[model samples]
Structures are given as C-alpha cells and as structure tokens.
Target: MNNQTISAQLLSPFNMGDLPLKNRVVVAPVTRSTVGEKRLRFMAKYYAQRASAGLIITEAAVISHQAIGWLNSPGIYTEEQAEDWKQVVNAVHSHKTPIFLQLWHCGRASHSSFQQNGQLPVAPSAIKVNGDYIHTPLGKQAYETPKALETEEIAAIVQDFSQAAQLAKIAGFDGVEIHGANGYLIDEFLQSKTNHRTDKYGGSIENRYRFLGEIITAMTKVLSPNRIGVRLSPNGSYNDMGSSDFRETFLYVAQQLNQYGLAYLHVMDGLAFSFHELGNPITLAEFRQVFTGPIMGNCGYTQETAEAAIEKGDADLISFGRLFISNPDLVERFANGWPLNPLVDRKLWYRLGEEGYIDFPAYASSS
Candidate 1:
C-alpha cells in the first residue's frame, strides 16, 4: 500500500479501526489540574479550540479516590465529573473531532495527603522513587515510600480503571486511553526497579505486565478492544522509573497486546528526558514489529520529524505535547506552513489560571 509523498500528509485522513480521524496529529495529554465548574468551563473551550486535531487525548483523569496525586486534577469516578467532562467532549465533537479520556493512577509518585484518610500511596512494592514531588493542597511534597498493594487491593485498582472506562463512555468521549506510561501505577508495576513483588502481579516480565493486562481485559467489558488504547514510556526516567529489562519487557508487552487487537499503541520514543540515554535505546520499530496495528510515536516531535516518521512508516500518528499547548491551530499551521507561536512561559503551564491556559493566540491571519 504505497501512498503519495505529499508535503502536508499529516493533514490526511486516517481510520483507526471504527474511528475515522481527519488528521494524524494527536494532542498528547498535559497536566492541567484546575478543577471546578469554572475551570471545567474554560477547559471545554480549551479543547474545542484545538478541534482541528485528529484526536485530543485529555489530561490524565484520576480513576478513583485512591488515584488523586496531582493538585485539583480531574476525576471520572463520580457522576458529577462525568457530567462535567461531557461539556468538553461535546465542544470538541461540535467540530467533528474525536477525543479519548486518559485514565491515570499516580501510584508511588503520590503523597498521603492526596490519599484517603492520609493512607499511604499504593504501589507494586514498598520502595520509594526519589526525585519526584507531588503538589498537594497544602504545598509541594516529596514522595514517600509507598505501601505495597495487598493482593486484594490490586484487583480493586483494576476495577477502578474498568469503572472509569464506563464513565468515560457516559461523558461522551470517543474512547479511553489507559495511562500505562510514565511512572504511574501501571508503569511502576511494569518496571523491575519498582516492582519487587512475588505475587502474580510481579516477579517475571509476564507477571509484571499482568496489572495492565487485567485492566485491559476488564475495561473491554464496557468498551471494545478497538475503542481502547494504551500509552507506554519504556525508556522514561520520569518519576524515577527504569529497569534492567527495559527492552525485553516492553517488547513482550507489545507482542501480547497484539492479541487484543486494540486501536493503537502510543509509545514514547524520543530520548529527551529519557532513561535510555545511559543505556541502549529501544526504537519504535521494535513495538511495530510485533504489534501489527496503528502505532503513535510521541515526545519531541516537530512537523518535519513527524512527517519523516510518517513517510518512513515509523509511525501511523504523532502526538504533539508542548507544541499543541501554545498553538491551538497546530494542524492548520503545519498543513499551510504557517509560523508557530513559540511557547512563552513555562511557569504558567501548571498554574491554575487562564493566563497561559487558554490565552495562547492563534496565528495572525494574513489577508
């Protein structure tokens, strides 16, 4: 299936199973923890502004009370939150765009202040991943050694994700992407450095991958495999996540996910902020080899590099992170070769205000 080497092919249509995409540009989930009707209202407008993107993966939304680690971050475990997210989904769909809600659990990257009754944060093991701080209502706090999830508690976490998938459907989202990336709950379970358990949820590579596998299985009871996706950062050092078996674990995980026939596998392939810098890097091609479906390459992707990736068959889609924040019309700018709005202030990124949140101006039109 040879396609044309068109200049702005990123603007072309793509069909991810039953979901048809207008372009290959995806809005990677960024942390925006401004919670409330006021903030949700602005967020609706924010996502609507970027409707030209083929897909918009929302900021990580907590699955349950136990999953809240970020300050004022959104949640999907309640009816109120689901009702609130509908506004954002409806706004984006008004422009005929598809959006996927990203479900997350921060695991050991959290503080007890974010947990119920100040209970210790749950993780695969009782080990602490240093150099990570979680913002609490009080203030920023360092990560503490987490409580190893009891065998029974692991099932509860998987149930939380499954229930979140059902709520996302009620919230009018096109689909849901399991936040298996970074050093979140699922990531901690996947890497050996964090997962030292001897149960069915850890130990061997297959056992470490079971936590996510169980989630995908349970989530499928509500959403089909075609409507579900998973994001993975096999080479990440973020939240202090890495392992001795980085290459072997991710490859096997990718191979097994193929059996589920999911929509796509979103992989963090760039070296910037990656733990693979000190070791041999694993390429996206490795995942593509076994997972014979759509692959979305993320991190540090520019228009030129993204186009090259698409041309060379390295990726079926490219998710833009910081670029999408400053340029609401990123797909349009890339399609027409328009100048992009440079990101001005990094501090405003996580702040709870409209200063840099929704104030990024679109390109000045040349009449």
Candidate 2:
C-alpha cells in the first residue's frame, strides 16, 4: 500500500458549514497553562507555528469569573483578556488559518484556592469528585465537596456563556466551540450520577439537556448557528461520571443538536486501553445518521487511524492532541509521510514559562 496515497486522502479539503478547511487534519484543544498577558504573546508564536493545520481549536477558555476554577487558564470575560485574544486571533488569521475558541467552565473540577475569595467549587450537586487532586497555591490536595447551583444560578450561567460568545467574536475568533464535555459543568448536568435534583434542571433526559440546550440557544443569539460548535464525551468516565443509559442520553442530545444546524459536533471517545473500549462511539457514518453537519472525532487517533476514519466516512475531520504538541508541522508531516517527533516531558505541560510551551522546534528549525 502506498502511504502517500493514504496521506493525500487524509489531507484533502473538507467543508464545515460555510468554512472550507485546507485539509482534513485539525489541531485539537489542549490546555498548557499558557495564559494571561504572557499567554497572549506565547499563543501568537505558538499558533503561528502550527498554522499548517486545516483548522485550529484553542485550549478551553473560561467565560466568567465564577466559571473559572483552574490556575493560569485564559478567560474571555474581562476586557483585558478579550483584547489579549484579539492579538491571538490576528496572528492566526495573518497566516490565513481559521481558529475556534473552546469555551469552558471547570465546575466541580475546581479547587477553593482557585475560586474567588477561596469560595467552594460549584457543581450540579454538592458531591465531591472521587479520587481527584487539585492544584493550590500551597500544593496539590484532594478535591473538596462543591456547592450545588440553584435553579436561578443556572440561568445566570447561561447568560455568562452568551456574553462570552459575544466576547469571542469581538476577539476576532472565527467561531466558538462550547466545552460541554470532559466532566465539566455542562457534563455535570448531563450525567445523572452527578446531577441528582428534583428541580427542572435534573431527573429526565430532557431536563438534563435543558442546560446545554439553553446555553446553545443563548450562544446562537450572539454567534451564528453555523459558526457555533459543541464538544461532548458520551461515555466519558472522567470526574466519576456515568449514567444508567449513556447511549440514550447522548442520542437525545445529538438528535436535538441536529435541529440547530450547527457547524460541527466534536466528540471525545473517552480514554480507553484500546480503541474498541470507546463507548457511545459515534462513527462519522453513525453520527451522520443523526447530525447532518460535519463531525470531528478525537481520542487515541493515529495518522493511519484518522485517515481511515475520514475514508470510511466515519468523520469529516480528525483532531490531533499530543501529535500536534510535538509536531508543529503535523499537517506537513502527514502530507509528506514524514516520521513524527516523540512527545517531550509531561511535567512541563503545565509548567509556567516557555520551556515546553513555545520552545518546541518546528521541522524548519530542525532542518
């Protein structure tokens, strides 16, 4: 089999709504603690380095002060942050690359030390995530019980997302991808195990989906339906999350999202020992059955696997995480069938400064 032929197939142009990708290869969102004033400067160089990708999805960015629970993660709620992002958007666009910001909220995954005035973490329930540690100014410690959000508070959260979407547009982002996956606040509401309430926000599947549906509706008011996207993890067990009926929950969400005519649906197929272990695994062909829009599939994908997914019509595009981290010219590597560089030290992933964040040499530099 000619690897070049396979590589060409993977690098072919694809469409998501009105946006045409240069190739099917996408750089997935990966948080690396590169934010604040320094983050703006670093991202300009960082994204500019990987401009070869067909599309670039930035790391999850908090939308509100209350929504923030992680250290050093960027936010779009403030004027300064929005202005900082403007530079990032300008840099990526200068290279003619379309970029999307992943809007996020940490929910119960946050530590009090990271909260305002050291307030408790918030979630759908007051439950504490089992066997998880959070970083504090002092050091890493076990997660604590989170404060349950009231029905009224939920409405406020929706408004925060809407405001954030507007800010993203102001920042010159091509689009906004709602971070509803990976056991975050939105995922907390989706999982029955995490959300145990008798109010309108909990219980039935429709009620559980109400939070996400409202957020999407609110965001669409600010961003066009075609310019908006959503990310989900149907069978993700992260943050001690699960449901009695995972497939039914995700199917309902997918079918409903299809009605909105969104740009794409990005799905994370939980961390599995093998690809076979990925549950609620919505293949590109399977997802097309429910959602008429484009689909981006992620998790444990190799170059060959991603190409096969696109060829088999399992996905319109493939999202690369660690591969993009090590290979700034991943699209070029895929196009030419060049061997990829191995990932550097994991300890440096969140470490401040440019040691691992911006110091990775590109293929040109290596040559």
Candidate 3:
C-alpha cells in the first residue's frame, strides 16, 4: 500500500455523529497509576501533549469511593475532583481537540484496602477475580471475594454513573465514555463467569445486560445519547474475563446499544491483549452488522491495520494506546512517515514520574 494512501485513510478527517474529528486516530484511555494532588498538573500536560488525536478518552476516572481500586488514580465523584479535571479539559481544548472522560467502577477488581472503612469490594456476584494479585493502596495483595450487590442496591450504583456523567459535563468534557470493558465493574456484570447472581441483574444474557443497560439509561438523562459511548472487550481474558456465550452476549449488547444511538461503540477486537480462547474471537464486522452507530476498533492497531479497518468500513475510528503513549505525534508520524519512538518498558508504564510519561519528544523536536 502507498504511504500517502495509507496516510490519507488513517490520518484523514472524519465525523463521528455531529462531532468533527481532525483525523481518525484516537488516544485511547490508559491507566497511568500516577494520579495525586500534585500529579493533576502532570495529568494535564500528559493529555495536552497528544491533543492532536481526533479524540482523547481520559483514563478511567473512578465514579465513587466504592469504584476505586487503582492506587493514585483520579476520581470524578466529588466536586473538587471534577474541578481538578476541568484544568485538564481546558488544556486539551486549548488545542481544539475534543476529549471525553471515561467513567469507571472497578467492582470486584478492587480490594477492601482501597475501599472506605475496609468494606469488601462490590460486584454482581460474590465470586473473586481469578487473578493472583491486585495493587491496593496498602500494597500488592491477593484478590478478595467481593460482596454481591443486592437488587435494591443496584439503583444507587446506576445513579452514580449518571452523576459521574453530569460531573464530566460540568468539567467541560465534550463527551463521556462508559468503561464497560476489560473485566471491570461493568464487565463483571456482563460476563457470566463473574456474575453468578439470580436477581433481575443476573441469570440469562438479557438479565445480565440489565446492569449496563440501566447505567446507559441513567446516564442519558444527564448527557445526550450522542455525547456518550461504551467500550466492550468481548475477546479479552484480562481480569479473568470471557465466557462460553461470549459471542452471543456481545452481539446482543451491540444490538441493544444500537437502539440508544450512542456516539460510538469502542470494541477491543485485537488479540494483542491475551484472548480468552474460548472459541473464535468476535470481530468488528460482527459489531458493525448490529450497531448502526460509528464503530471504533482498538487494541494493537498499527497505522496500516487501522487504515485497512477504516478503508474496509469496519471501523470509523481507530484508537491507539501504546502507540499514543510512545508517539505523541502519532498522526503526524503516519502522515509524514516519521520513525516512531521505541515502546516504553512495561514497568515504567504506570510509574509516577515524568521519565517515561511525558518526556518523549515529537518528531519536530526530535529531528
């Protein structure tokens, strides 16, 4: 494929609903594990550095104290936290780049150490994550069996997502993406392996989807459906996710979400993150068939692969996580064929410092 042709496809301008993008490339949300009072300033710089991307999804911000698990990660539950994030939004908007806040709830992925008053983490079921360890504020600790949320308690958590969406708007975010992927709180409710409840929120696929469905309904009350997005990781094994009915579950999810007319459906279709290997992985084409809205494909997409996905009509936008981290000027590199910086070491990915976070120079500076 011609480099210029490749550039035109991936780095080209596109419209996701009413939102116009400068390019089709997206800065996927990444957990830096480096947020604190002092780190908020760094967070602003970190996101502002890559404002050239078509859209930027800020790292998953915990929706409530019950939603926190990652150490030092930002939270949007309080007015003060939302005010802090407003600065980051201003920094990105300074470049005329549209950014979205990803509302997250860690669910059973968290430990009591991260919870208030040392209460057990909550989930749809009482099962514990199969993972060996979770990084808590105390230290690296074993995964704890979570408290199963009662049917009566589900409404409050759903309202938390709604309140978080409203807070995101107040923070001046152009939009909000619900973090429903990668074995997090929402994902735990979606997958059968994790959700073992017999209430209205569990049992069959429709019942299982009720938790996320209610979240969307609640969020739409504060934010327009067009200003919202949802992420799904049907093929991932992260946090011990993936079920026997994975294909049926996600396709049904897409079909239902289609009725909502969301801004986009972000699907992690690439196997770069280990796949569950239960059966054949679900593809973007599968989602495209059901979801009528714009589709964003993520996970391990190179310029060539991203270009192909868009050119083939499989994805309207392609998000880059590691690439965006290393090459802040990823769109320019694809447009001009500049050499990309080497991938940073995994250990340094979540470290709290400027060494490997925002120190990488763009091609203009490097050359």
Candidate 4:
C-alpha cells in the first residue's frame, strides 16, 4: 500500500516522551503460558512478529514469588528469567521495536497452589470477590479470601515492585508499564470496595492511591518518568470489580499521576466486558481534561474507530488486543484498508504449542 492510502492520523509519526514511533498504533499485552524455556523462545518469536507496533507492551509478568496468581504467566524476578528475557529483547530490537515489560501482582485473585508452601493469597483486606475463579495446578478454583497485608508487609510488596522494575531494566526492556488495572494488587488497593484498611493505606482516595504513587516513585529511581507509563481501568468489571465512588476516586488518581509526568495513561472502557455500570461512567475525554500526558484508549477499537478517536482528540494513541492476536500485520492491513481476518480461535488461547500462538499468518500469506 502506498502512503497516500494510509490514514494520516495513524501513520503520522508521533512522540510519546522518549519513545519516537513510526505510527500511533500499539500492540497491547496478551497473556501466554510461560511454563518453560521453550515458551520464552516462543515469546521472543511472538513479539518479534508484531514489531511493527509503535510500542509493544509485554504480558503482565509477576513481580515476586509472593505476587504470583496467574498459573502459567512469565516472570522476571530471578536472574535466569531476566537472562531469558534478554533473548526476547534482542528479537524485538532486531526490528527496531520499542517494548515495555508490564510488572504485575495478582493480589487476591489467586489460589493456594500458585503461592509458595500453600500460603494464602495477599491483598489489602481479607475480602473475596466471588464469581471469579483462578487456575491452579490442581485445576480451576474459586477465589480465595486473601490474607490482609500488614503495614510492614505492604512496604515489602512495594519494594518487590521496585526490585522487579530494576530487573526489567536489566532484561533490556525500553521501559516498564505498571499493571495498576484489572482488579489486581494495585487495583485492589485503589478500589474502596476491595480495600477495607483503616490505616493510611485505605480510607480515602488519597490513601488508596498512596500505594500506586509510591510504586511509581520507586520505579522512577531506575527509569525516567517520561519513559514510564501506567494502565488503569476505572470502569472495568473484568475481575468482578467496582466501587460506589469510581468517578471521584479515578479522577483523583488521574490528576495525581499527572504530577509525575508519565509517558501515557492506558485506559480500558466502553467494551461489554469492561462495563462501568455501578458508578457514574467516565470517558477518555474526561481523563484527557485531568491528565496532560498522552492517553491511550483500549478495549475493542477498530481502525476506523481508532482514527476517529484520535481526530476527535479523545486519545493520543489506540491499542489493539484481539485484532493483534489474529493479525500480525494489523497495522499494514489497516494502513492499506485491507479487511481484517475475523478468524480468532479462542479455544487455543491457553493450550500449549504454537498452533494458535505464533502460527497466525501475516497479511501476504492470508491474502
């Protein structure tokens, strides 16, 4: 496709702080089982195929032994794991793609088997969000009522995140994105419904946001604030999450994050799965009003819709999830106005091997 056929907004060069890109399209993180060395090899190939992205955010990797919940997700806490990740960085960098490792902790969304010595999952409170199930080695199990982290223990978790950020740097990531969304550890603290702590960590909005702010501060010691970005889902029900005062809480959080001069704010809303039904619904535009840095709008954005959102000034960039999974050449397809491949095999998302993982054909082969 010629440059004339591509939409100007998407193909136009853009700058997101230290990240200069050929376009504003990003490949959002997607979970793949990290069971062994072979998987990391697969992961390297998985990311390299989509290196055309302006920025690639890797799947959420657990920060520490205490932070695991996803049964098969990858990690970066150990020296060996970091060494393995170096291969991934080399693969993506070969194509000159800028990538970020997303540091995460599952919090209460975990079962005993995933934790060391069968220890209970940890969170801000002993509350359990029912209806959500976690996959364990034994099999899928219901969510556990997590052990409440003592004030001292809370600090340890922060340090774990700090350590992980440094490890990510050592692994050769361009930067890191804190996974502060999707009802995980950081999100558990931010939401009033989940955080019942009476101490400084949980009463009001500021208290709830304290945990997230401290994490950002810690990461900045090793990486530039301009190179750091955060993902938040103020209106998501993915992990059975919600609060009575989501608007006030999230707006306060957004306003505060602006002070750090972050690279971008990636938000997920307006999709059937990410509904904000319980509270006053907030949009990306409202966040734009509060945060000066760029905002990336996620959750099922088509090429036409993404371009329109950018033109309307609602978002500086648009991230693709499922589309990127099935179309390795998603940007090229969109740029050339080629029809998207609607054949997504969801059944193989968690299955082992490369059939549905790295086997998706590029545009040339598919056409």
Winning model by lDDT: 3
Question: What would you estimate as the lDDT of candidate 2?
Answer: 0.82
What are the per-residue Cα lDDT tens digits for candidate 3 across 200-298? 888999999999999999998998899999999999999989899999999999999988889999999999987999999999998989999999999
Off by over 4 Å in 3: 37-39
Misplaced by over 4 Å in model 2 are 36-41, 270-285
Worst 10 residues of 2 by lDDT: 270-279
How far out, in Å, is residue 46 in model 4? Answer: 0.5
Question: Which of the numbered candidates is closest to the native, going by highest TM-score?
Answer: 3
After best superposition, candidate 2 residue 185: deviation in angstroms? Answer: 0.3
Against the true structure, candidate 4 has what lDDT? Answer: 0.85
lDDT per residue (tens digit) for residues 1-367 in model 1: 1223343567788999999999999999988666663225478888988989999999999999889788777889988889989999999999999999999999988889878899999899999877846677668788789999999888888899999999999999999999998899999999898999999988999999999999999999999899999999988889887787899999999998998889899999886656645468778877778888899999888888787888788789999988989899888788666778886466777766686888877775432
Segments of candidate 1 deviating more than 4 angstroms: 1-6, 37-41, 276-278, 365-367
Error of model 1, residue 274, in angstroms? 3.2
* Shift in Å, residue 155, candidate 4: 1.0
lDDT of each: 0.87, 0.82, 0.91, 0.85
Q: How would you encode candidate 4's per-residue C-alpha lDDT over 159-262 as one tens digit per residue?
A: 88888988988999998899998899999999998999999999999999999999999889988898788998888877778888999989899999989999
Tell me the deviation in Å of residue 68 in model 3: 0.4
Pick by TM-score: 3 or 4, better one: 3
lDDT digits (tens) for residues 154-194 of candidate 2: 98899989999999999999999999887899999987878
